[model samples]
Target: MLLSRKAWEIDLREARKMRHSEVLGCCPHDCQDGCSWVAHVEDGKVTKVVGSKEHPFTRGVLCAKVNDYQTRTYAPDRLLHPLRRTGAKGSGEFERISWDKAIREIAFEFGNIINDWGSEALMPLHDMGSAGALQRRALMRLFHHIGASRLHGSLCGQSGNAVAAEGHPISFDPETLAESECILLWGANLLSTAHHHWHFCLEARKMRGAKIISIDPRRTRTAAKCDEHISIRPGTDAVLAAGMANVLVEEGLADFEYARSAADDLDACLEEIKAWTPDHVCEVTGVAPDDVVRIARIYGAARPGTLRVGIGPQQSRFGDVFVKSLSALAILSGHWRLPGGGLSIEGYPTFDNAAPECPELSPEGTRSLHRGQLGRILTSSDLDPPIKGLMIWGHNPLVNQIDAETVRQGLCRDDLFTVVIEQFMTDTARHADIVLPSTTQLEHFDVQGSWGHCYVGLNHPAIPPLGESKPHTEILRFLAKEMGLDEPALFADDETIARSCLPDGFDWATLNQQGWLFAPQPRRDPASMGGSLKMSMGLDGPEDLNVRDPIAIGKLRLLTVKPHYLLNSTFANMPRQAGQQGNPTLEMHPADAKSLGLQDGDRVLAQNGKGTLAAMLRVTDAVLTGTTVLEGKFWWTANEDGSPVSNRLANSNWTEGGQPTFNDIFVEVTATSGFADI
Candidate 1:
């Protein structure tokens, strides 16, 4: 209430004054390119935004999304107050409620669910929405104390992290890429996906003459800018990677001694790749055998070639397998030791030490959930009484999940009580039993680190939380206290949580002033280099070769791929962004389109066994025949009577590691006449 009073006073002042200086802070959204922006406030209103020149990561640059902050921050459709559904579930009908009543209602329902079904039935789904470390960790601590069903393995980087853990000691620093002679932009588009990295890539090109080779199914902005683009079939990255390793071995381009030393079972691994010759791989990946060999040779011979592995390569059914194979290419080529010559996987560097202290919920014991199967978890009676209570934060499962219709059904279930904390009335929020207003990055203070860049940024609050919105940390703290959780210490302030993340003896004041933290250099020893090769290569063995089972036949293999623009549906609700790109549509190759009697821009019914969706067709050669590509950010919308559109294409039974593989589903497409343009 005090904050609101202050905000009102600021607003009144803004009406009297045209402009006023407001210190800028970093916007720590679930984006690879964390932007630095300064707010112009007159009274209490934000009148303008500009790039922060002092911010090292952004370097005074702001993306289109950041430039449109006014629309996103104070949009008419924003959840200005808490709301409880008054109409039937999924009806987009809600009545405004005060924060006091909202929180009390949520607590009462959640407590009742816990009392009746036990903690395991109450599932807390947390992702990148409120990325503040204290906020996320507090939820984990609360769930731990209350015995809630915990979400595990990470919907985003489980496979990539597994590869990084198994293969390298640390990711190749982005700064080192500028020194490379050659760079492989593997399965990722840095220009659109990781915008901040694009600046570095451009510098590497201009300064170091770094030759860029982009390997992806679509000709993205990065692909268009690269020196060469090798378009390959989706889900065949592993075969191509293995083929490269084979070429390195056969042409004597590999450091045989180093391979043997790095990996304990180097000889066995080499032998395993013998079957991955260019010809064999070409058959599977649809890439020419000679072209594969040529690319491999270029990569192997290039002095200090950097391999930047993108997250898209690891989104398939065999995501972990592909990541591991790619890592092997780097090791076999002996690229790991040189600067800018290693794998780079995208992820947020969380300082949360919950893993080291809480071994039960640590990274080691984390379970992998199928990001696509969110709907089934909510709706299925077979899930042992089903998840009774749900808490949605950071992520919008309705838009990001593979088969969205199923998720809608699950959310609409009478038995499933849902609470969504969000900035806007997202598709997922519309189905929630209660929706709580959440603060934007501009309203919170925290530190952020990028997987691409090494610099850690400090996010200072630039404006008061808008309307009735609350920072996620405060929400979790209040919940913890109300629930009487055992470890109240876990719900500490952002400053305390930030301090805990740093290594002991670090100067907090200096770090805040600098607005960035560089990871400490790993102590290097010449003695350690001798066994590095052996340690790296020792994992390859005959048994390890057959660890993964062969891909099943006859079933439709759906791969829910991310496009360059939207990565996991974060920017879907931004009006300016949505206006530019419109709603996400499905893309298929011309040959496949004709075979299915679908035309470009035609409304087609796309269905797997579980569900179907009607989407506008985008016919292009960019996608390979028989494979369909759809943008991953379309919120499931209902018909006039309330039947959801986007959810129609989801498969309920298709799950992997307790998560659904939306991308691994086999679907059939046909032109639909009655559908409206999506």
Candidate 2:
């Protein structure tokens, strides 16, 4: 009675065939890469994930992270149902609950908190996790409608962006880099950190004959491939850059006429940088004085040299100062306006895309909360009130932020009610009183724009959301409705949201059909500057300026560093990536390691006045002898036995950008009694 094998297979396929349809979609993942992908659907299920050859940004290729779309969508660890904590907080105990009940409970508690402590008590900590335009806007709108406490200040790129805004705000198109003769890659390890850009850089080096100069504290993959690698002392990037400028001026390489024409106060800037001579810079940066001269001559003399400044440069105490100095260099060399020239603070083109006016969410008139003050907020000192309720989505601050112990204590507060929306049970999720399951990129429809490239991409739903999982926008809508608020204004469908957010004169339907969009060419010269120094600086030029005193003498700042790959802790749960480097470690020079009576792989305790974390020593000449490098991606949670590591030691000191100089806080390291298992 058994059917033939071929017959059985054919019959099974026929039985499963419910319908076939083509949909226009884009991958709405948190990555800056923003890949455009196609979904093959049969019987309401995604059968294949393919790159859209037509996508200008993706260019018919996908990364290893996105290639496993099926696995990530169907991962066993994904939250399939809403749950409420049934045990003590941080106990990781929960009970399954329906979505309706979960929404009602969340709304009630959130409303109560707002009534008692004002909207600022309920902080919604969000990041790139749910980057869809609708999802992001909906959350902000809901918070505004509910009068809930809001989170402000981006942990990423705010300093760099501010500096860029102050100068020539526009970004250079990525395609333009291919035409450059020389590229100065500073602090960024594009090869391992940004894979797609790494490919372009490699191509530019080998095929286009572009000379690449890498400047970083580490001998990264990007540095390895460069024509020359300049390893400077960490946190002293500004000093080195200033020295390079000094060399340019001294060697008669400065484009003084260009600076006078392009800058606001060329004489003041020149005077400020004059004291930063190569000899003085050599003493501070530890780079050879002659190397400074060589780099300045080459970078200044090269006809279309481009400077690509990495996010790492802005993660320290004087991050903003460093960015400003770098911008000043570009201005002095007349590299700010030319094609194949200028500096790139970040490769992402999303900044160039016009955003709707969101004045309510703006930081104006709001009491600022610096990211480094997590401990104080949790502890509820006399100066700061306790965070009564917390709503976290798309970001994992407990795992990523410095001073894990303080954050853990803050989350452990009995008075605090925490809600977490996530795809999986992340370290941050473990502390939540309520957990809402969220949909992945494969289960949603959205448009994506890259910070790295100019092209915008559209995402189509590749599969039905797994189990009861819902998109963040849906969750926001439900919460808004439950709170007795008008939900339409807060939540619009994906297509409508995308259309509204797109630049003027662009239609959503047209974008969907084409699967991408591009902005019009930028005007080369605005005619505002009349090619004269007097016109550029306006009347009363150099005498109208007031300069500040120089930085005081002190120990060089040593801040914890994180690359774009592990920006915060969102990606830590991805086994293939995070498991390879389980916890944060101390990166030190061999001489420094010896000075501290430590060796490679030895366990050491890195501590400041606020906290401490156990770290394994990794000795290399890449790090400056006086400084220590700690990758900032460790869960603040206690181990299986309830012991904390690196998060315990993060400094809570503040910096100008509302972020702590976590890296700049000097620490004393001592060899542990026992070495780490690694």
Candidate 3:
């Protein structure tokens, strides 16, 4: 037996297989591009993660935040086990605990809360931390089973979507951008937010002589590259879109034949636009009347003109109005008849799947709370049991939410018991009573739907759980069994869920090997539906165009934008990513800085009725005279010296569509310590 050469060769083959291997996965972060990636594992450790070269949409590209993902997974400060708070809340002091003990404690606390205050007292809050369908839905299945207060998502205004329904919302494939004649980046910071889409836009510009225009309050990175940038006033996007609609109709540039065939309310929309003349729009929007006419002509004359809507415009108090206005503009342009000639809102592809939320398990009339009002929900007397137990995952509200001070106060309550599932001790995690370690994308099984392009990705676990950490599904499974609950859905295997999410008859093993599959774009055009598009113009008269606020004298509209290197608070802690972002600075127009008697690099305080924030100033003309820009999703501890976070001054008020009005905030700035010594 010892001399058998065939036995030795068989053993060597097994060793070679184990030593080097590649696992397919999808990027879990909440980004427009749900990129497919390959994890190279050597000796049971992930050596590197690279974008899949075979993915048509990803094209072997990964954003700066995710290119070095192995570093993030193996970061020194990554949480490796369950822990219990050992000091005051928000102190970041915790002691390691056993997995069995951790599960038992959670079971006991959750049971106690339910018995004392009914299951509605328990609230589970989450955001798009991981866009993977399984990771997002696992905890929801547990919460629904327990009849906890449901979190009504606040990522966007559904009211705006409801208005979009009047006319079929057709999101043409971004790949078709190569065919577009005129591309209007309306409120879309594509170069910063969705860089993949910008590739196609650039191709159109260079290949077909396409005209690109950027319409925004600040001259964003995308705007800097565009042929023209229209610096419109904040909250006036609806006015500009309405003006363009008027010009399209008045100048006889509108596709009257297409409009009559595709839209049922064309006559009514005509009446609405009559009041939104170019001059009146200029008075309200601060855009030149001639520029409005010119842009309108460009869009109207092009056979395949298109518009791309962004999250920025819908964060205003009248977000629904903005969506409706933009929708009307596109409908009147009659661009949907051709490829790349319609409004493009990033959308997820549909799949044959089970209900991730398991709404069927929820009790009748279970209370639902909005995420925008988290502070109010926790502190309000109107809530009967008042959120006794809060479980958080997939979100860091303290850094991302509006009214930071109020959220802080709510988290600091002694009576409240909070459980946080995280990979790192984020600002919100530090305040939790129990911190459970969670696995990174490299250690999980997931499926992803792209909001940026038409592709679906598969993720296979590349390595075992690093320590006592587990995937969201495994964590929930352990807790579910510990609590003596027996829901079939709660115990479903991750691979099964992932496989069911794919199209029927798709080969799972083949998909795992290939990394991704092309999801064909659906036909959403009105002509295909055999019906006319019916939509409200969202404006009635001059009064509807007015967005001016009678604020305190020196107040300027504070515009908070997303950083290019960070997705919300996800990569804010990485040294390399943080270094790229540098210190957070408030950008003020030269005229505004001069009016306030301040210079660039000066330390200033922005205060409003809600709260105040401190930051260094950069005097630049990128912003308009009456506005200031601060781009970030920085952690609460971003400033090493312990200063307030950027969202402290944001208004918690909801938009007309029930979304956070982070862009509608108005604040006054004053020199705090004058120019920094450096």
Per-residue CA lDDT of model 3 for 120-168, tens digit only, reads 9999988788877787776788899999998774655454555655656
After aligning candidate 1 to the native by TM-score, how far in Å is the CA of 270 from where it should be? Answer: 1.0
Question: How would you encode candidate 1's per-residue C-alpha lDDT over 1-678 as one tens digit per residue?
Answer: 356888999987886665565665666666666666677776666777777787656777777556656557777777778999998887879999988788788778878987887767777777766455654445565655566665555556667655454434436567667777778899877776667777667777898787889998777777888999897766677878888888988898997665655566566677778887898777677689998988888888877777787776666556766766766787778776576676666534334435312325323433333434576677666775468888888778776665676677788888888999888888889889899998776677776556555555666776788899987778877776666655645466667756766666666676577556655344221123454432222223212211121122222233455544444666665656766665446778786777667789887666656666666678988665556676555555523222233435555532132333344556677777755553
lDDT against the true structure, per candidate, is: 0.66, 0.66, 0.81
**Residue 140 in candidate 1 has what lDDT?**
62
How many pairs of residues in model 1 come into backbone collision?
Answer: 36
| Candidate with maximal lDDT | 3
Higher-ranked by lDDT: 1 or 3: 3
Instruction: For model 1, give the 10-residue run with minimal summed lDDT.
Output: 542-551
Q: Highest TM-score: give the candidate number.
A: 3
lDDT of 2 by residue, 365-389 (tens): 4444554455576677663444787
The collision pairs in model 3 are: none
RMSD of 3: 3.6
- Local error of candidate 2 at 665, Å? 4.3
